[model samples]
Target: MDAIREWLAGHKREVIRFAVLFMFLAVCLFGLGRLISGNTAETDTESLQLDETYLAASSVESDQTPVQPQESGPAQEIIIVDIKGAVKNPGVYQAEADMRVIDIIDLAGGLSETADADTVNLSQRVTDQMVIYIPAVGEAAERPIAVPENNLTEQEIGNEEAGTEKVDINTADAVLLQTLNGIGGKKAALIIAYREENGSFQTIEEIMEVSGIGEKTFEGFKNLITVGAK
Candidate 1:
């Protein structure tokens, strides 16, 4: 026991050195593990931030999409015409711009029993202020019973009755031009400007050359316009 004690005392410095080296190694291992864990946590946080940024960017891009334009067709136009003779409800009735005699006949409650359907041109296109006369069967007439609105004499009668005169587009002032159907202050000014820029209209149809004066607008005032000087 005395010899063992002497040997232990002699190796005490070596034992102390060994214990210090072991504690240093343990501390280095623990620091290395903590560094590795911290790096992993930081990488995960960066990856999460990247994912959130990508999602936010995608949402913003989706919200900024443009809308496509919607196409619109031409506006429908209404016309007035007179139906007489064998129609069930013969008088002035509203018609569409493209209505034919047969279509208007249906609008007037169809033809009467005595209507001479064969004598009339059912396929003819109806116009504003047109007179559709469905004559009685076997009836004889000298002049055409179905007179179109283009027949100037009938137009004169209508204008006279309505106390409206056909305006000369070539010479009419803005106030006079506004008297025509569908012609407002703006349209009248446009017409005058068009005439001053391009001279007087040679025909009534040339009025359509003015902006906002399409075929539909022209149709409303065609019968009430003239190119000739008043």
Candidate 2:
């Protein structure tokens, strides 16, 4: 019994030191495990928050997109018409495709006090480059004019009526030019050739500049012809 007590007394310090070292290692391992778990949880929370924020931004952007408008119809057609003679306002005017002669006359501030309204077909549709002529009250009519005691012959009245039909040199063909006082087929051809070579004639006087035509020839048909609209 005295030998056993002496052995236990000698090993007591070494056993106490070993136990303290084991306790320190266990505490350090537990603290390391807890730190790693906390970091992982924080990372997962941040990832979830970022994913939610991105989804919300996408939804908002989609809601703010603009819608496009639809087209209605084709554009309207524009046309030019020349209003002349006894209209209150005599000039060229722009008109829509659907416009009639009366519509154009209205655009020209309606017919004049002396306008022969019955001589014009107001219901007729207006066309591009069309010329609308409104004659005066005493001018040519579908109804015959009373031959006064002044003794004007029927043939003379007929000649006067024929004079009112002025030929447009700018648009006249060979046949139409022949209707003029001194214009023959050859002269008509030369006129057309000159026109083609140097664009359209700017004025009725410009026809005198054509080859073989002079002031005398122009004076013969000057009152019977027009240059029309340029």
Best by lDDT: 1
Report lDDT (CA) for all predictions: 0.75, 0.72
TM-score of each model, paired residue for residue: 0.40, 0.37
RMSD of 2: 13.2
Clashes of each: 0, 0
Say which candidate scores most in TM-score: 1
Number of residue pairs clashing in candidate 1, backbone atoms closer than 3 angstroms, sequence gap of 3 or more or interchain: 0
* Model 1 C-alpha lDDT per residue in residues 1-230, reported as the tens digit of each score: 99988987999898899999999999999999999999999999999999999999999999996888988988768866667678898766777889889988998999999988988898998875566667788776433555653353323322322343567899998766754545666888999999999998998888888998877656655766778852
User: Over the stretch 1-230, how does candidate 2's per-residue lDDT look in tens digits?
Assistant: 88877876898888788889999999999999999999999999999999999999999999996878988888779866656678889766778988888998999999899988887788887765555667788885532221111222333222334445677888888766654444555787999999888888889899999887877667655766778756
> Cα deviation in Å at residue 220, candidate 2?
15
Candidate 1 Cα misplacement greater than 4 A, ranges: 1-65, 69-71, 150-230
